[model samples]
Target: MDWDDMRVFLALARVASLGRAGQVLKMDPATVGRRVSRLEGHLGRRLFHRSHQGYALTEDGLRLLPHVEAAQAHLSAAETPNDTGAGLSGQIRLGAPDGCANYLLPQVIARICADHPALEVQIVALPRLFNLSRREADMAISVSAPQAGRLHVQKITDYHLHFAAAASYLDRHPPIRQIADLRGHSLIGYIPDMIFDKELDYLANLDLHAARMTSNSVPVQLNLLRQGTGLGVVHDFALPHAQDLRRVLVPVFSLTRAFHLVRHADDLRNARLRRFAEALIVGLRDQVARLEQAVAQADDQANSENP
Candidate 1:
Protein backbone atom coordinates (compact mmCIF):
# COMPACT_ATOMS: atom_id res chain seq x y z
CA MET A 1 0.00 0.00 0.00
CA ASP A 2 1.46 3.32 -1.13
CA TRP A 3 1.28 6.12 1.49
CA ASP A 4 0.86 8.77 -1.22
CA ASP A 5 -2.11 6.81 -2.61
CA MET A 6 -3.65 6.72 0.88
CA ARG A 7 -3.15 10.48 1.16
CA VAL A 8 -5.09 10.94 -2.08
CA PHE A 9 -7.81 8.61 -0.87
CA LEU A 10 -8.16 10.58 2.40
CA ALA A 11 -8.32 13.90 0.56
CA LEU A 12 -11.05 12.57 -1.74
CA ALA A 13 -12.99 11.07 1.16
CA ARG A 14 -12.85 14.30 3.15
CA VAL A 15 -13.68 16.73 0.33
CA ALA A 16 -16.05 14.32 -1.48
CA SER A 17 -15.13 15.93 -4.84
CA LEU A 18 -12.30 15.36 -7.27
CA GLY A 19 -11.81 19.04 -8.03
CA ARG A 20 -11.62 20.07 -4.41
CA ALA A 21 -9.39 17.17 -3.38
CA GLY A 22 -7.14 18.02 -6.32
CA GLN A 23 -7.03 21.58 -5.06
CA VAL A 24 -5.87 20.33 -1.65
CA LEU A 25 -3.25 18.16 -3.25
CA LYS A 26 -2.29 20.82 -5.85
CA MET A 27 -3.07 18.34 -8.63
CA ASP A 28 -5.50 18.40 -11.53
CA PRO A 29 -8.86 16.66 -11.30
CA ALA A 30 -7.79 14.12 -13.93
CA THR A 31 -4.68 13.31 -11.88
CA VAL A 32 -6.73 12.89 -8.70
CA GLY A 33 -9.21 10.60 -10.45
CA ARG A 34 -6.39 8.46 -11.85
CA ARG A 35 -4.71 8.24 -8.47
CA VAL A 36 -7.95 7.14 -6.78
CA SER A 37 -8.52 4.51 -9.44
CA ARG A 38 -4.94 3.28 -9.05
CA LEU A 39 -5.37 3.06 -5.28
CA GLU A 40 -8.61 1.07 -5.65
CA GLY A 41 -6.88 -1.33 -8.07
CA HIS A 42 -4.00 -1.77 -5.63
CA LEU A 43 -6.43 -2.49 -2.81
CA GLY A 44 -8.46 -4.95 -4.94
CA ARG A 45 -11.65 -3.51 -3.46
CA ARG A 46 -14.04 -0.78 -4.47
CA LEU A 47 -13.49 2.10 -2.01
CA PHE A 48 -15.75 4.85 -3.30
CA HIS A 49 -19.14 5.09 -4.97
CA ARG A 50 -18.80 7.81 -7.61
CA SER A 51 -21.68 10.14 -8.43
CA HIS A 52 -22.13 13.48 -10.14
CA GLN A 53 -22.31 15.23 -6.78
CA GLY A 54 -19.11 13.69 -5.41
CA TYR A 55 -17.52 10.41 -4.29
CA ALA A 56 -18.89 8.67 -1.23
CA LEU A 57 -17.09 6.01 0.77
CA THR A 58 -18.17 2.40 0.16
CA GLU A 59 -18.64 0.06 3.13
CA ASP A 60 -15.11 -1.14 2.55
CA GLY A 61 -13.86 2.42 2.36
CA LEU A 62 -15.54 3.22 5.69
CA ARG A 63 -13.95 0.12 7.21
CA LEU A 64 -10.53 1.24 5.98
CA LEU A 65 -10.95 4.87 7.14
CA PRO A 66 -10.02 4.59 10.84
CA HIS A 67 -6.93 2.49 10.15
CA VAL A 68 -5.76 4.97 7.51
CA GLU A 69 -6.46 7.93 9.83
CA ALA A 70 -4.36 6.32 12.57
CA ALA A 71 -1.51 5.78 10.15
CA GLN A 72 -1.81 9.40 9.02
CA ALA A 73 -1.63 10.57 12.63
CA HIS A 74 1.49 8.52 13.26
CA LEU A 75 3.11 9.86 10.11
CA SER A 76 2.25 13.42 11.09
CA ALA A 77 3.67 12.89 14.57
CA ALA A 78 6.91 11.50 13.13
CA GLU A 79 7.25 14.47 10.76
CA THR A 80 6.53 17.12 13.38
CA PRO A 81 10.08 17.20 14.76
CA ASN A 82 11.62 17.61 11.30
CA ASP A 83 9.03 20.27 10.37
CA THR A 84 9.67 22.30 13.51
CA GLY A 85 13.36 22.54 12.63
CA ALA A 86 12.77 23.06 8.89
CA GLY A 87 10.49 26.10 9.46
CA LEU A 88 6.93 26.46 8.15
CA SER A 89 7.08 24.97 4.64
CA GLY A 90 3.65 23.53 3.81
CA GLN A 91 0.36 24.90 2.47
CA ILE A 92 -2.53 25.95 4.64
CA ARG A 93 -5.98 26.45 3.09
CA LEU A 94 -7.82 29.12 5.04
CA GLY A 95 -11.52 29.57 4.44
CA ALA A 96 -13.25 32.83 5.33
CA PRO A 97 -16.14 35.06 4.28
CA ASP A 98 -15.50 37.69 1.60
CA GLY A 99 -15.71 40.56 4.05
CA CYS A 100 -12.79 39.20 6.10
CA ALA A 101 -10.80 37.89 3.16
CA ASN A 102 -11.00 41.12 1.15
CA TYR A 103 -10.75 43.64 3.94
CA LEU A 104 -8.76 42.00 6.71
CA LEU A 105 -6.87 38.75 5.96
CA PRO A 106 -4.59 39.79 3.10
CA GLN A 107 -2.37 41.97 5.27
CA VAL A 108 -2.15 39.33 7.97
CA ILE A 109 -1.40 36.57 5.49
CA ALA A 110 1.19 38.72 3.73
CA ARG A 111 2.94 39.37 7.01
CA ILE A 112 2.92 35.67 7.83
CA CYS A 113 4.36 34.86 4.41
CA ALA A 114 7.06 37.48 4.82
CA ASP A 115 8.12 36.01 8.13
CA HIS A 116 7.97 32.44 6.87
CA PRO A 117 8.70 32.52 3.15
CA ALA A 118 8.32 28.77 2.70
CA LEU A 119 4.69 28.78 3.89
CA GLU A 120 1.87 28.95 1.37
CA VAL A 121 -1.57 30.21 2.36
CA GLN A 122 -4.57 29.66 0.14
CA ILE A 123 -7.61 31.74 0.96
CA VAL A 124 -11.04 30.35 0.03
CA ALA A 125 -13.53 33.18 0.36
CA LEU A 126 -17.14 32.05 0.09
CA PRO A 127 -20.50 32.67 1.76
CA ARG A 128 -21.06 29.05 2.79
CA LEU A 129 -19.54 27.18 5.69
CA PHE A 130 -16.26 25.30 5.40
CA ASN A 131 -16.47 21.78 6.80
CA LEU A 132 -13.43 21.36 9.03
CA SER A 133 -14.29 17.67 9.44
CA ARG A 134 -13.84 17.28 5.68
CA ARG A 135 -10.59 19.31 5.65
CA GLU A 136 -12.19 21.85 3.32
CA ALA A 137 -9.81 24.29 4.95
CA ASP A 138 -6.90 23.83 7.32
CA MET A 139 -8.38 26.67 9.27
CA ALA A 140 -11.56 28.71 8.89
CA ILE A 141 -12.65 32.12 10.07
CA SER A 142 -16.37 31.71 10.59
CA VAL A 143 -19.20 34.06 11.57
CA SER A 144 -20.35 31.86 14.43
CA ALA A 145 -18.65 29.26 16.58
CA PRO A 146 -19.12 25.61 15.72
CA GLN A 147 -21.55 23.92 18.07
CA ALA A 148 -20.62 20.32 17.31
CA GLY A 149 -17.47 18.99 15.67
CA ARG A 150 -14.10 17.46 16.49
CA LEU A 151 -12.64 20.93 16.11
CA HIS A 152 -10.83 23.57 18.09
CA VAL A 153 -12.79 26.85 18.16
CA GLN A 154 -11.91 30.26 19.50
CA LYS A 155 -13.38 33.76 19.21
CA ILE A 156 -11.06 35.87 17.07
CA THR A 157 -12.81 39.22 17.29
CA ASP A 158 -16.11 41.02 17.45
CA TYR A 159 -16.62 43.25 14.40
CA HIS A 160 -19.31 45.84 13.91
CA LEU A 161 -21.58 46.73 10.99
CA HIS A 162 -23.75 49.77 10.38
CA PHE A 163 -26.38 50.99 7.97
CA ALA A 164 -24.30 52.90 5.47
CA ALA A 165 -24.71 54.68 2.14
CA ALA A 166 -22.82 56.99 -0.14
CA ALA A 167 -23.03 60.60 1.02
CA SER A 168 -24.26 61.69 -2.40
CA TYR A 169 -27.15 59.20 -2.26
CA LEU A 170 -28.20 60.27 1.21
CA ASP A 171 -28.07 63.91 0.23
CA ARG A 172 -30.27 63.34 -2.83
CA HIS A 173 -32.78 61.06 -1.12
CA PRO A 174 -35.41 61.76 1.51
CA PRO A 175 -34.18 61.70 5.07
CA ILE A 176 -34.39 58.40 6.90
CA ARG A 177 -35.90 59.53 10.18
CA GLN A 178 -36.78 56.13 11.60
CA ILE A 179 -36.86 52.39 10.86
CA ALA A 180 -40.26 52.81 9.18
CA ASP A 181 -38.77 55.43 6.83
CA LEU A 182 -36.63 52.62 5.36
CA ARG A 183 -39.70 51.36 3.48
CA GLY A 184 -39.94 54.63 1.54
CA HIS A 185 -36.29 54.41 0.36
CA SER A 186 -34.30 52.03 -1.71
CA LEU A 187 -32.25 49.57 0.35
CA ILE A 188 -29.36 47.33 -0.56
CA GLY A 189 -28.59 43.99 1.11
CA TYR A 190 -27.81 40.30 0.61
CA ILE A 191 -30.28 38.27 -1.38
CA PRO A 192 -32.27 36.51 1.33
CA ASP A 193 -32.26 33.18 -0.45
CA MET A 194 -28.53 33.27 -1.12
CA ILE A 195 -27.59 33.85 2.52
CA PHE A 196 -25.70 30.69 3.52
CA ASP A 197 -25.25 31.34 7.23
CA LYS A 198 -28.04 32.30 9.56
CA GLU A 199 -25.72 34.88 11.13
CA LEU A 200 -25.51 36.57 7.70
CA ASP A 201 -29.27 37.10 7.55
CA TYR A 202 -29.03 40.80 8.42
CA LEU A 203 -32.15 41.84 6.52
CA ALA A 204 -34.39 39.63 8.61
CA ASN A 205 -33.74 41.77 11.70
CA LEU A 206 -34.56 44.97 9.86
CA ASP A 207 -37.87 46.43 8.70
CA LEU A 208 -37.14 45.54 5.09
CA HIS A 209 -39.67 44.48 2.48
CA ALA A 210 -37.18 44.01 -0.33
CA ALA A 211 -33.72 45.16 -1.28
CA ARG A 212 -33.34 47.62 -4.14
CA MET A 213 -30.16 45.77 -5.04
CA THR A 214 -28.96 42.40 -3.76
CA SER A 215 -25.73 40.41 -4.06
CA ASN A 216 -24.07 37.48 -2.30
CA SER A 217 -20.70 39.22 -2.20
CA VAL A 218 -20.05 41.71 0.60
CA PRO A 219 -17.73 43.66 -1.69
CA VAL A 220 -20.52 43.91 -4.29
CA GLN A 221 -22.96 45.13 -1.67
CA LEU A 222 -20.39 47.70 -0.55
CA ASN A 223 -19.74 48.74 -4.14
CA LEU A 224 -23.43 49.35 -4.73
CA LEU A 225 -23.53 51.36 -1.51
CA ARG A 226 -20.55 53.39 -2.71
CA GLN A 227 -22.16 53.92 -6.12
CA GLY A 228 -25.02 55.66 -4.33
CA THR A 229 -27.42 52.86 -5.20
CA GLY A 230 -28.87 52.38 -1.72
CA LEU A 231 -28.18 51.94 1.96
CA GLY A 232 -26.93 48.58 3.20
CA VAL A 233 -25.13 46.93 6.09
CA VAL A 234 -21.43 47.72 5.86
CA HIS A 235 -18.58 46.49 8.01
CA ASP A 236 -16.57 49.15 9.85
CA PHE A 237 -13.26 47.78 8.60
CA ALA A 238 -14.42 48.47 5.02
CA LEU A 239 -15.37 52.09 5.80
CA PRO A 240 -11.79 53.42 5.68
CA HIS A 241 -11.47 52.74 1.95
CA ALA A 242 -14.80 54.18 0.80
CA GLN A 243 -14.36 57.82 1.78
CA ASP A 244 -17.62 58.86 0.20
CA LEU A 245 -19.67 56.44 2.29
CA ARG A 246 -20.99 57.26 5.77
CA ARG A 247 -22.68 55.19 8.40
CA VAL A 248 -26.32 55.96 9.13
CA LEU A 249 -28.12 55.13 12.40
CA VAL A 250 -24.85 54.50 14.13
CA PRO A 251 -24.74 53.01 17.66
CA VAL A 252 -28.48 52.30 17.34
CA PHE A 253 -28.52 50.18 14.20
CA SER A 254 -25.01 48.82 14.58
CA LEU A 255 -24.58 45.05 14.77
CA THR A 256 -21.79 42.99 16.29
CA ARG A 257 -20.75 39.60 14.95
CA ALA A 258 -18.06 37.36 16.39
CA PHE A 259 -15.41 35.83 14.14
CA HIS A 260 -14.32 32.40 15.30
CA LEU A 261 -11.14 30.52 14.43
CA VAL A 262 -11.78 26.84 13.73
CA ARG A 263 -9.49 23.93 12.89
CA HIS A 264 -9.86 20.16 12.78
CA ALA A 265 -8.62 18.34 15.88
CA ASP A 266 -6.08 16.28 13.95
CA ASP A 267 -4.59 19.24 12.12
CA LEU A 268 -4.25 21.20 15.33
CA ARG A 269 -1.47 18.85 16.34
CA ASN A 270 0.63 19.71 13.29
CA ALA A 271 3.40 22.20 14.11
CA ARG A 272 2.92 24.29 10.97
CA LEU A 273 -0.81 24.52 11.48
CA ARG A 274 -0.40 25.52 15.13
CA ARG A 275 1.96 28.33 14.16
CA PHE A 276 -0.42 29.62 11.47
CA ALA A 277 -3.34 29.53 13.90
CA GLU A 278 -1.32 31.57 16.38
CA ALA A 279 -0.42 34.10 13.72
CA LEU A 280 -4.05 34.45 12.73
CA ILE A 281 -5.15 35.03 16.31
CA VAL A 282 -2.44 37.63 16.88
CA GLY A 283 -3.28 39.37 13.59
CA LEU A 284 -6.98 39.54 14.36
CA ARG A 285 -6.31 40.79 17.90
CA ASP A 286 -4.20 43.62 16.50
CA GLN A 287 -7.17 44.78 14.43
CA VAL A 288 -9.62 44.79 17.35
CA ALA A 289 -9.76 48.56 17.89
CA ARG A 290 -9.94 49.32 14.20
CA LEU A 291 -12.70 46.81 13.54
CA GLU A 292 -14.75 48.06 16.49
CA GLN A 293 -14.52 51.77 15.64
CA ALA A 294 -17.73 53.61 14.84
CA VAL A 295 -18.21 53.93 11.08
CA ALA A 296 -19.56 57.47 11.20
CA GLN A 297 -17.98 60.60 12.61
CA ALA A 298 -19.43 62.01 15.82
CA ASP A 299 -20.26 65.43 14.38
CA ASP A 300 -22.06 64.07 11.32
CA GLN A 301 -25.75 65.02 11.18
CA ALA A 302 -26.65 61.37 10.64
CA ASN A 303 -25.32 60.67 14.12
CA SER A 304 -27.43 63.39 15.77
CA GLU A 305 -30.89 61.93 15.21
CA ASN A 306 -32.44 58.52 15.63
CA PRO A 307 -33.56 57.02 12.37
Candidate 2:
Protein backbone atom coordinates (compact mmCIF):
# COMPACT_ATOMS: atom_id res chain seq x y z
CA MET A 1 0.00 0.00 0.00
CA ASP A 2 2.96 2.28 0.71
CA TRP A 3 6.57 2.55 -0.45
CA ASP A 4 7.77 0.91 2.78
CA ASP A 5 5.49 -2.12 2.26
CA MET A 6 6.44 -2.34 -1.44
CA ARG A 7 10.13 -2.21 -0.48
CA VAL A 8 9.67 -5.27 1.76
CA PHE A 9 7.73 -7.02 -0.98
CA LEU A 10 10.44 -6.33 -3.54
CA ALA A 11 13.27 -7.50 -1.29
CA LEU A 12 11.47 -10.76 -0.52
CA ALA A 13 10.49 -11.25 -4.15
CA ARG A 14 14.13 -10.96 -5.18
CA VAL A 15 15.67 -13.22 -2.52
CA ALA A 16 12.64 -15.39 -1.88
CA SER A 17 13.42 -15.72 1.85
CA LEU A 18 12.45 -13.92 5.05
CA GLY A 19 15.89 -13.93 6.71
CA ARG A 20 17.62 -12.93 3.49
CA ALA A 21 15.09 -10.23 2.76
CA GLY A 22 15.56 -9.04 6.35
CA GLN A 23 19.30 -8.84 5.74
CA VAL A 24 18.68 -6.79 2.61
CA LEU A 25 16.23 -4.43 4.33
CA LYS A 26 18.08 -4.36 7.69
CA MET A 27 14.88 -5.54 9.41
CA ASP A 28 14.20 -8.51 11.67
CA PRO A 29 12.97 -11.72 9.97
CA ALA A 30 9.77 -11.65 12.09
CA THR A 31 9.10 -8.03 11.05
CA VAL A 32 9.71 -8.86 7.43
CA GLY A 33 7.23 -11.74 7.58
CA ARG A 34 4.71 -9.52 9.36
CA ARG A 35 5.02 -6.77 6.74
CA VAL A 36 4.47 -9.25 3.93
CA SER A 37 1.42 -10.72 5.69
CA ARG A 38 0.02 -7.27 6.39
CA LEU A 39 0.48 -6.20 2.78
CA GLU A 40 -1.21 -9.37 1.52
CA GLY A 41 -4.10 -8.87 3.94
CA HIS A 42 -4.61 -5.29 2.70
CA LEU A 43 -4.80 -6.47 -0.87
CA GLY A 44 -6.89 -9.57 -0.02
CA ARG A 45 -4.78 -11.42 -2.56
CA ARG A 46 -1.77 -13.61 -1.79
CA LEU A 47 1.49 -12.24 -3.21
CA PHE A 48 3.77 -15.10 -2.26
CA HIS A 49 3.65 -18.84 -1.59
CA ARG A 50 5.64 -19.71 1.53
CA SER A 51 7.23 -23.11 2.01
CA HIS A 52 10.37 -24.82 3.34
CA GLN A 53 12.24 -23.93 0.15
CA GLY A 54 11.62 -20.19 0.05
CA TYR A 55 9.02 -17.51 -0.65
CA ALA A 56 7.88 -17.86 -4.26
CA LEU A 57 5.80 -15.19 -5.91
CA THR A 58 2.22 -16.16 -6.63
CA GLU A 59 0.36 -15.14 -9.80
CA ASP A 60 -0.55 -11.86 -8.17
CA GLY A 61 3.04 -11.14 -7.09
CA LEU A 62 4.35 -11.57 -10.62
CA ARG A 63 1.69 -9.18 -11.86
CA LEU A 64 2.58 -6.65 -9.15
CA LEU A 65 6.36 -6.70 -9.71
CA PRO A 66 6.64 -4.28 -12.66
CA HIS A 67 4.56 -1.57 -11.01
CA VAL A 68 6.59 -1.71 -7.82
CA GLU A 69 9.83 -1.69 -9.81
CA ALA A 70 8.63 1.37 -11.74
CA ALA A 71 7.95 3.17 -8.46
CA GLN A 72 11.38 2.15 -7.21
CA ALA A 73 12.93 3.59 -10.39
CA HIS A 74 11.18 6.90 -9.81
CA LEU A 75 12.34 6.99 -6.19
CA SER A 76 15.87 6.01 -7.11
CA ALA A 77 16.03 8.79 -9.69
CA ALA A 78 14.72 11.30 -7.16
CA GLU A 79 17.16 10.22 -4.46
CA THR A 80 20.21 10.72 -6.67
CA PRO A 81 20.42 14.47 -7.12
CA ASN A 82 21.29 15.51 -10.66
CA ASP A 83 23.55 18.56 -11.42
CA THR A 84 25.78 17.61 -8.46
CA GLY A 85 28.80 17.92 -10.81
CA ALA A 86 28.77 14.12 -10.84
CA GLY A 87 27.55 12.90 -14.23
CA LEU A 88 25.14 9.95 -14.11
CA SER A 89 25.90 8.63 -10.66
CA GLY A 90 24.16 5.23 -10.72
CA GLN A 91 24.37 1.78 -12.20
CA ILE A 92 22.42 0.91 -15.37
CA ARG A 93 22.26 -2.55 -16.89
CA LEU A 94 21.91 -3.41 -20.58
CA GLY A 95 20.88 -6.72 -22.15
CA ALA A 96 21.94 -7.45 -25.73
CA PRO A 97 22.35 -10.32 -28.11
CA ASP A 98 25.89 -11.70 -28.03
CA GLY A 99 26.96 -10.52 -31.49
CA CYS A 100 26.65 -6.79 -30.79
CA ALA A 101 27.67 -7.30 -27.17
CA ASN A 102 30.96 -8.83 -28.21
CA TYR A 103 31.88 -6.77 -31.27
CA LEU A 104 30.30 -3.35 -30.79
CA LEU A 105 29.38 -2.61 -27.15
CA PRO A 106 32.88 -2.31 -25.67
CA GLN A 107 33.99 0.86 -27.48
CA VAL A 108 30.58 2.48 -27.09
CA ILE A 109 30.50 1.70 -23.36
CA ALA A 110 34.04 2.99 -23.02
CA ARG A 111 32.99 6.34 -24.48
CA ILE A 112 29.87 6.62 -22.30
CA CYS A 113 31.76 5.63 -19.13
CA ALA A 114 34.61 7.97 -19.95
CA ASP A 115 32.18 10.85 -20.24
CA HIS A 116 30.28 9.86 -17.09
CA PRO A 117 32.93 8.91 -14.55
CA ALA A 118 30.38 8.25 -11.79
CA LEU A 119 28.30 5.89 -13.94
CA GLU A 120 28.34 2.12 -13.68
CA VAL A 121 27.10 -0.27 -16.35
CA GLN A 122 26.40 -3.99 -16.31
CA ILE A 123 26.19 -5.80 -19.63
CA VAL A 124 24.08 -8.94 -19.88
CA ALA A 125 24.91 -10.65 -23.18
CA LEU A 126 22.78 -13.66 -23.96
CA PRO A 127 21.07 -15.25 -26.97
CA ARG A 128 17.54 -14.32 -25.98
CA LEU A 129 15.01 -11.54 -25.59
CA PHE A 130 15.43 -9.76 -22.27
CA ASN A 131 12.31 -9.38 -20.10
CA LEU A 132 12.12 -5.60 -19.68
CA SER A 133 9.02 -5.88 -17.44
CA ARG A 134 11.02 -7.84 -14.87
CA ARG A 135 13.90 -5.30 -14.93
CA GLU A 136 16.28 -7.80 -16.48
CA ALA A 137 18.22 -4.76 -17.61
CA ASP A 138 17.57 -1.02 -17.68
CA MET A 139 17.40 -1.39 -21.45
CA ALA A 140 18.20 -3.92 -24.17
CA ILE A 141 19.63 -3.92 -27.70
CA SER A 142 17.41 -6.07 -29.85
CA VAL A 143 17.97 -7.08 -33.47
CA SER A 144 14.29 -6.55 -34.16
CA ALA A 145 11.90 -4.16 -32.43
CA PRO A 146 9.39 -6.17 -30.49
CA GLN A 147 5.76 -5.61 -31.50
CA ALA A 148 4.44 -6.44 -28.02
CA GLY A 149 5.25 -4.82 -24.64
CA ARG A 150 5.01 -1.45 -22.93
CA LEU A 151 8.36 -0.21 -24.24
CA HIS A 152 9.98 2.52 -26.31
CA VAL A 153 11.82 1.27 -29.38
CA GLN A 154 14.45 3.16 -31.35
CA LYS A 155 16.26 2.01 -34.45
CA ILE A 156 19.88 2.53 -33.48
CA THR A 157 21.64 1.61 -36.72
CA ASP A 158 21.80 -0.73 -39.67
CA TYR A 159 24.68 -3.26 -39.80
CA HIS A 160 25.78 -5.71 -42.44
CA LEU A 161 26.49 -9.45 -42.62
CA HIS A 162 27.90 -11.75 -45.26
CA PHE A 163 28.82 -15.37 -45.89
CA ALA A 164 32.37 -16.10 -44.89
CA ALA A 165 34.75 -18.98 -44.22
CA ALA A 166 38.31 -19.57 -43.18
CA ALA A 167 40.91 -19.61 -45.93
CA SER A 168 41.85 -23.20 -45.15
CA TYR A 169 38.24 -24.36 -45.30
CA LEU A 170 37.74 -22.78 -48.70
CA ASP A 171 40.97 -24.31 -49.98
CA ARG A 172 39.95 -27.77 -48.82
CA HIS A 173 36.26 -27.68 -49.77
CA PRO A 174 34.53 -27.17 -53.07
CA PRO A 175 34.07 -23.61 -54.22
CA ILE A 176 30.73 -21.90 -53.55
CA ARG A 177 30.18 -19.96 -56.76
CA GLN A 178 26.43 -19.89 -56.26
CA ILE A 179 23.89 -20.47 -53.55
CA ALA A 180 23.17 -23.94 -54.97
CA ASP A 181 26.82 -24.88 -54.47
CA LEU A 182 26.29 -24.79 -50.65
CA ARG A 183 25.33 -28.47 -50.72
CA GLY A 184 26.95 -31.14 -48.51
CA HIS A 185 28.39 -28.41 -46.25
CA SER A 186 26.77 -27.05 -43.14
CA LEU A 187 27.37 -23.47 -42.06
CA ILE A 188 28.37 -22.56 -38.56
CA GLY A 189 25.55 -20.57 -36.97
CA TYR A 190 23.16 -20.24 -34.03
CA ILE A 191 21.23 -23.31 -32.99
CA PRO A 192 18.17 -23.13 -35.26
CA ASP A 193 15.64 -23.44 -32.47
CA MET A 194 17.69 -21.20 -30.18
CA ILE A 195 17.83 -18.20 -32.54
CA PHE A 196 16.18 -15.51 -30.42
CA ASP A 197 15.28 -13.22 -33.32
CA LYS A 198 14.17 -13.75 -36.88
CA GLU A 199 16.76 -11.20 -38.04
CA LEU A 200 19.49 -13.56 -36.81
CA ASP A 201 18.37 -16.48 -38.93
CA TYR A 202 20.81 -15.51 -41.69
CA LEU A 203 21.22 -18.99 -43.07
CA ALA A 204 17.52 -19.83 -42.93
CA ASN A 205 16.75 -16.70 -44.91
CA LEU A 206 19.20 -17.93 -47.52
CA ASP A 207 17.46 -21.34 -47.63
CA LEU A 208 20.61 -22.86 -46.21
CA HIS A 209 20.98 -25.16 -43.22
CA ALA A 210 23.46 -24.89 -40.32
CA ALA A 211 23.55 -28.23 -38.52
CA ARG A 212 27.22 -29.27 -38.66
CA MET A 213 28.48 -26.73 -36.12
CA THR A 214 26.19 -24.48 -34.08
CA SER A 215 26.00 -22.60 -30.82
CA ASN A 216 23.81 -20.05 -29.04
CA SER A 217 26.76 -17.63 -29.00
CA VAL A 218 27.94 -15.61 -32.00
CA PRO A 219 31.52 -15.56 -30.71
CA VAL A 220 31.56 -19.34 -30.53
CA GLN A 221 30.25 -19.60 -34.08
CA LEU A 222 32.85 -17.05 -35.21
CA ASN A 223 35.57 -19.08 -33.55
CA LEU A 224 34.26 -22.20 -35.24
CA LEU A 225 34.52 -20.45 -38.61
CA ARG A 226 38.05 -19.31 -37.77
CA GLN A 227 39.04 -22.94 -37.20
CA GLY A 228 38.69 -23.76 -40.90
CA THR A 229 35.92 -26.25 -40.14
CA GLY A 230 33.11 -24.75 -42.26
CA LEU A 231 31.54 -21.64 -43.69
CA GLY A 232 29.17 -19.25 -41.92
CA VAL A 233 27.50 -15.84 -42.04
CA VAL A 234 29.28 -13.24 -39.93
CA HIS A 235 28.72 -9.62 -38.99
CA ASP A 236 30.90 -7.11 -40.83
CA PHE A 237 31.92 -5.45 -37.59
CA ALA A 238 33.12 -8.78 -36.27
CA LEU A 239 35.24 -9.58 -39.35
CA PRO A 240 38.06 -7.40 -38.11
CA HIS A 241 38.40 -9.48 -34.93
CA ALA A 242 39.32 -12.67 -36.80
CA GLN A 243 41.59 -12.18 -39.78
CA ASP A 244 41.69 -15.78 -40.92
CA LEU A 245 37.97 -15.82 -41.66
CA ARG A 246 37.46 -14.30 -45.12
CA ARG A 247 34.23 -13.24 -46.72
CA VAL A 248 33.02 -15.40 -49.58
CA LEU A 249 30.08 -15.10 -51.97
CA VAL A 250 29.79 -11.50 -50.81
CA PRO A 251 28.12 -10.49 -54.05
CA VAL A 252 25.67 -13.32 -53.67
CA PHE A 253 25.09 -13.41 -49.91
CA SER A 254 25.01 -10.25 -47.82
CA LEU A 255 22.47 -8.93 -45.38
CA THR A 256 21.56 -5.67 -43.72
CA ARG A 257 19.92 -5.72 -40.26
CA ALA A 258 19.15 -3.05 -37.72
CA PHE A 259 19.78 -2.86 -33.99
CA HIS A 260 16.95 -1.51 -31.86
CA LEU A 261 17.17 0.23 -28.50
CA VAL A 262 14.36 -1.05 -26.25
CA ARG A 263 13.34 0.27 -22.84
CA HIS A 264 10.28 0.24 -20.57
CA ALA A 265 7.69 2.96 -21.22
CA ASP A 266 7.48 3.82 -17.50
CA ASP A 267 11.13 4.87 -17.43
CA LEU A 268 10.61 7.51 -20.13
CA ARG A 269 10.07 10.10 -17.41
CA ASN A 270 13.36 9.09 -15.72
CA ALA A 271 16.13 11.44 -16.83
CA ARG A 272 19.01 9.02 -16.26
CA LEU A 273 17.67 6.39 -18.68
CA ARG A 274 16.80 9.08 -21.22
CA ARG A 275 20.35 10.43 -21.19
CA PHE A 276 21.93 6.98 -21.45
CA ALA A 277 19.65 5.95 -24.32
CA GLU A 278 20.58 9.03 -26.33
CA ALA A 279 24.29 8.48 -25.82
CA LEU A 280 23.91 4.80 -26.75
CA ILE A 281 21.99 5.56 -29.93
CA VAL A 282 24.49 8.14 -31.11
CA GLY A 283 27.52 5.99 -30.27
CA LEU A 284 26.14 2.86 -31.98
CA ARG A 285 25.39 4.64 -35.27
CA ASP A 286 28.89 6.07 -35.35
CA GLN A 287 30.56 2.77 -34.39
CA VAL A 288 28.65 0.74 -36.99
CA ALA A 289 29.51 3.25 -39.70
CA ARG A 290 33.16 3.35 -38.65
CA LEU A 291 33.49 -0.44 -38.53
CA GLU A 292 31.65 -1.08 -41.81
CA GLN A 293 34.00 1.39 -43.48
CA ALA A 294 36.97 -0.60 -42.23
CA VAL A 295 35.43 -3.77 -43.62
CA ALA A 296 34.95 -2.10 -46.99
CA GLN A 297 38.53 -0.83 -47.04
CA ALA A 298 39.82 -4.29 -46.24
CA ASP A 299 37.75 -5.78 -49.05
CA ASP A 300 39.07 -3.16 -51.46
CA GLN A 301 42.68 -3.93 -50.50
CA ALA A 302 42.08 -7.66 -50.96
CA ASN A 303 40.62 -7.12 -54.43
CA SER A 304 43.38 -4.73 -55.56
CA GLU A 305 46.10 -7.14 -54.44
CA ASN A 306 44.48 -10.22 -56.00
CA PRO A 307 43.43 -8.65 -59.25
Question: For candidate 2, which ten residues in a row score worst on lDDT?
Answer: 80-89
User: Which clashing pairs does model 2 show?
Assistant: none
> All models: lDDT?
0.81, 0.86
Off by over 4 Å in 2: 1-57, 69-86, 173-175, 207-210
**Alpha-carbon lDDT of model 1:** 0.81
For residues 13-55, could you state the per-residue lDDT of candidate 2 as single tens digits? 7667899779768899999999999999999999999999999
Best-performing candidate as measured by lDDT = 2
Give the TM-score of each candidate: 0.82, 0.83
Residue pairs with clashing backbones, model 1? none
Tell me, by TM-score, which candidate is best.
2
Q: What 10-residue stretch in candidate 1 is worst by lDDT?
A: 294-303
Model 1, 1-307: lDDT tens per residue? 8898899998888778999889879999999999989999988999999998889888998777656766876777777765555557767789999999998898888988898898888999998789765556778999988889777888988888888889899899777757776786778888888898898888787756888799999999999988888888888888876778877776467688989998877665566677778888899767655555534353254447744
